[model samples]
Each structure stands twice: as C-alpha cells, then as structure tokens.
Target: MAGLTLSQASRALGKSKSTLNRAIKTGRLSATRNEDGTFSINPAELYRAFPEPSRNTLPERPKEPDRTTVPDDLGSRISLLQQLLEREREAVADLKEDRDRWRQQATSLLANQEAAPAAPPLVKRHRWWPF
Candidate 1:
C-alpha cells in the first residue's frame, strides 16, 4: 500500500512529528517501520485517525499598512539634505582657496630670502703686546 513518511504525514495533518509519534504509540494510528528504521504512515489511516479541520475556521489577523504608500515628509527631508550638501561644498571650496593663498605667500617669502645677499663675516684685529 502507498504510504507517506512521518514528515509528510505531519505536514498533511498540521500536527508535529512528536504528536504523531505519540498517536502511534497510543495505538490511535497505524504505521510501519521501514528498513532504515523510519516510520511510514498510510494517508488513509492518518485521515481516519484525525479528520481535517473545516476551512475559514481560523481568526483573521490584523492587516498592516501598505509599504507602497509614500511618506508625507519625504520632500522636506530631501530639501534639507540638499541644503546641507551645498553648505559642505561651499566650506570645502573656501578651505581650498585659503590653502592656495598661504602656499603662494610662503613661496614668495622663500624666493626673496634666497635672492638676498649673505652678510659679510666680521674681521677681528689683534693688538701687538709691547714688551
């Protein structure tokens, strides 16, 4: 006879493996052990043991809000982000300009120092000692 494994029987009957095992142990349902020591239950025997529940008998769950709806404050958030980005860009440009001006001033000062002449060494005259 055709049969279903314990896992298949559990899925069909909406019951757990342990529950079905208990039922078999209590002699409520019949199953045969396979060569691999696994139980195979006949589908007819399973239904005879536990009838399927009626459809639409379960309570309906509360519905969640749809994800497709756009948030009301999205436009304002985008504008705020854009303003922040512009401020950051302006600050970076100002920093770059200041850095260039300082670099030019340093270069000019170095060049002028190099072009200037070196000071002459001081000459020292030693007076002869009269004996």
Candidate 2:
C-alpha cells in the first residue's frame, strides 16, 4: 500500500528519476497526482508492471575497434611495385634484342643455301614414224 516518491521509484527500480517521470508522463505507468502538484507511484503495481527492470534498459554503447590503416604505407608499397615492373620490362627488351639477332643470322644462312645452283635436269628424246 506504499506510494513511492519519484526518487524512491528510481532507486527501487534501478532507473533514472527522469526516466520514471517520462514513463509516468507518457501514460506507461499509473501514478497518484499529489495535492502539491507532485506525484507518487504504487510500488506493487510497478513491480507487477515491470517484473524485470533489465528488459527496459537502453542498449549499451559499443566499444571502439582498434582497426586502422596507414595511407602513407600503401603509397610507398605502390611505388616499390612500379619500380620492380620497370626493371622487368627492361630485361624483357634486352632478351628480345638477342633473339632478333639470332633470327637474322639464321635467315641469312638459309638464303645463301638457296642461292647456290642446283643440278641440271636430265632429258631423253626418241621418235618412231610409220608413214
């Protein structure tokens, strides 16, 4: 039969006084309008209405994560990769020059072999007439 004051409701229910006042103001909980314009709540009714106060709590703030990236490190890594690509390109060009030199010499030798004369063709001639 005890009518708890606003602060008492906050302590007993483990809620903020402002939160309880809001609930009462928002028509969620029944309260007694006092003679001096104050308010009171039935403790039993509150316990029955909210058996578990934990259920009414707002969600906790999430902990900040430790994940972060450095933009300067990424830029330096890209510069290193580009330098390696340019060196590989120079090596490929030098190998291509060596291959072209070998191909030209082979083409010259084949041309000389074909330019030498071939053996003359053999021919046979015979004639028979019954006129």
Candidate 3:
C-alpha cells in the first residue's frame, strides 16, 4: 500500500511493467509479492537497480500559440523571410559582377598577347666514330 506498484514503477522509470516484473523474477531487482499477486516495489530498491531517466531524454513539446497572436507571428515571420531573400539576391548580383569582370580581363589579356617567332630547322651531320 505504501510502496509503488509494478505499473507505477514502470511509468516512473519510463519502462514497461513486464520489464520490471522480469527484473524481479531474475533477481536483478527486489520487490514484494502481495496477496493479490501484484508486485509492491520499494522506491529505493527500484531506483538502485534502474536509475530514473534524465529530463533531457524526453522530447520537448512545442507550446501552442495564442489564437490572437497567430496573425502577428505570421506577419513577422514573412517579413524576416523577405529580408533574407533580399540579402541573398544582392550577394548573387555581386558574384555575377565579379564573374563578368574576370571574364573581360581574361579576354583582353588573350587578345593583347603576341605570337613567338618559329625556330630555324637544324641540318643533320655525319659522325666519323662509329663507337
């Protein structure tokens, strides 16, 4: 009556009742077998074998927004997205300008380059020593 039941222990530990029952049967955890054939687990004993789960283990649920603030929230989000889009467009325009400037420089350098004169052909000479 004082201690936690198997189901209660399972819920607190974020595990199944069958798991706790198995632990008790396998001597991994200690529990009392009640007259009604239910387990009466001591909080200390249960925790000693299986520590309570940390708060970080549970997933966080998002809070629902107020109905009246929904429209304002949407407006703010849209404005922020628009600002980001404008910044991205400006960056792309700057990159395009740089690319155009580089292309013009390359074409000008190629056009101004002078061709080198061709070398004269060499005549073959006969060697006197065969070795």
Number of colliding residue pairs in each model: 0, 0, 0
Select the stronger candidate by lDDT from 1 and 2. Answer: 1
Give Cα distance to truth, residue 126, candidate 1, Å: 99
CA lDDT of each prediction against the hidden true structure:
0.86, 0.80, 0.83
Please report, as a residue range, the 10-residue window in candidate 2 with the lowest summed lDDT: 55-64
Give each model a TM-score.
0.41, 0.38, 0.40
| Cα lDDT over the full model 2 | 0.80
Q: Locate the minimum summed-lDDT window of 10 residues in model 1.
A: 55-64
Number of backbone clashes in candidate 2? 0
Better of 2 and 3 by lDDT: 3
* RMSD versus native structure for model 2: 24.8
Worst lDDT window (10 residues) for model 3? 55-64
RMSD of each: 19.8, 24.8, 13.3
